[model samples]
Target: MASPALTPTTPATRDVVLVPPAIAMVWTGAGRPHEIVAVPGVVLGAGETLVAIELATVCGSDVHTVEGHRAAPAPLVLGHEYVGRVIEVADGVRAVDGAHVQVGDRVVWSIMASCRECDRCRRGLPQKCRAVLKYGHERIQTHWELTGGFATHAHLRAGTAIVRVGESLRAEVLAPAACGGATAWAALARADEVADVDGATVLILGAGLIGLSACAMATDRGATVVVADPDPARRALAVRFGAAQVADPRDVRALTAALAATGSPEYDIVLEASGSPRAVQAALEVVGVGGVVVLVGSVFPTEPLPVDPERLVRGLITIRGVHNYAPRDLDAAVRYLRDRGAARPFEELVSARYPLAQIDQALAAASAGRAVRVGVDPRDAHRRC
Candidate 1:
């Protein structure tokens, strides 16, 4: 007889008691088992706040972390893109009162926390702040400091980085803006410096969340956008989201022919979000000699790409890597969503929503590309308990 499948069960505490602790799905190591552990209540310090997580989304970077493609320590908090409510605020937090952020005020936060005294912070590049504490990096050895949104609540050190979500947006859709959407917006902002979008030709490699968002943002900026992806469903969705053209990234000959037929040998700018070495090479081939290539996706193991150094020297192609979003980038993304009513059709991108108990199922679905985005709602499981 075949073995039975293991169904995800509601997390249970010791002694069969139903205590609502922070449940986190953690990876032990490379090729090791993953489990859900219920951690005791996290304590907050002065000028800190505990946010009750409303919704958290699984991202591609999360997959990289799980598969040990990156140097992630075991038993780490996993999520970065999320929306939550302020449950408690510590003493000495005067700028934001209970009125400004009550016990139930919904908000979204940035993944990176920076010290204002850093030179990068002074220059408005908090993403590169020298005293930054990334949620997943194990180097930061502060208790209750490295926790992320994957749990029931995340601890936030007080600063001006958090953005209060307006009533018009939903948590499921707004969760991804903290990372994916913000990254795309920052890449587009940099690409705009070299290519005037009023009537320029732009190409995006990858039709995933960041790629589609790039298409929408470039269209909003008046650029004609072309998208390349292997998935037909994503390509169709890109068209609906405002892509003028779609092609397959693997078929370089076809892509070249298509571009040639359009009377342009190269696009003014190429946005690479696929993180594939081939995609990066293709972006170099597709962009004009003087065009720019903005890399927004994460590349693991620091692999080298098959690029001709001679071509790079002669092409003068401006290649830039965008790490994370600045505070101003987040504000700009919020404004774009509000002004253009861009998120009205965001429901289509949300492929599934699972209770926190089904976190394993959610991660599986995301890994299989079964959805554009998968959300975890903690309230559902909390209610059952």
Candidate 2:
């Protein structure tokens, strides 16, 4: 006969029993992720903690993985954007800031963990460390099988910075701070820590989470902002987020003027977050000479465009690519959400919240581009505590 069942109390305190592996949406190399009933019960490893995920948001990169456009570790859990409360921690465990991350503290962790001894990390580029481990993108063979956020409980690995979020922010508002918001913040960091944005004309190529977040940050820096997106709803939302001007991407006038600098002063900065190859090519074309072009969208293989080598050389364009952000970027993201979340319609970006059982439905809406971000509660289907 099976042993007596383990029942944990509310919020899953440290002394709570080890519940069975909560449900997790496993991605197994397909156009959609498969909802697998994960084997429950996660034991805390040394310097590691078990976090009961309170909220998780679907990211565009996760969508790419589901669509097979981006290759990820198969048989892996697919979400990394999440906010949760620490329920259990191993002995000697503490956050990067040296504070003991106690149970019940609202938290968000950086997506990628790096070894400080790595050359890239030593030089301050941990995001690209030779042996970086990114949660939600790792294989099941990693330290913990339940490392991703598409589960009821996530294993917070060592070296992962646990940034304490302000208690006033809602779950949806704080969910993307580590991934989407952090990526946006890090990309814009190339602009002299946003100090140069004051009085500068900034044009963003997408109105998704990253783009809109960048718009808010840019406005905070006193930049004149214009945003472009084909979706009317997104354009409206962008305007609400502090864009001075909004334009449809298909507009001939907007496209022509974006990079030519012929009819108007070319934008001082061009941010490509549309995840579209066409947008990237257009960005290269639209910026004026000496302008900076920052690419944040994780656009994978697509039809390539020919480049005018001499034209590129003459423009003196500074094109930079940013992936999972550095630690400082995550700090900025938390601060941004904490300060401006109340005023901005951060939750508006989430069209609807869906239970994990209906994850396929959520993924459908996300793929259709109807929702900018979709919230998933693993406990929605099966509550563990």
State which candidate has the highest TM-score. 2
Q: Candidate 2: TM-score?
A: 0.89
Q: Taking the tens digit of each residue's C-alpha lDDT, what string does model 1 give over 160-250? A: 3677776777786688888888888899988878777666788888988888877888887788788889998888888887877788889
lDDT of 2 by residue, 155-257 (tens): 7665577888857888888888878899888888875443366767888889999999999988888877888899998999998899888887766477555
Quick one: how many clashes does candidate 1 have?
Answer: 0
Residue 371, model 1: lDDT of 87
Please identify model 1 stretches exceeding 4 Å from their true place. 1-22, 30-40, 90-103, 136-146, 257-265, 341-344, 383-385
> Each model's TM-score?
0.85, 0.89
Sequence-dependent TM-score of model 1: 0.85
Q: Each candidate's lDDT (Cα)?
A: 0.71, 0.76
| Global Cα lDDT for candidate 2 | 0.76
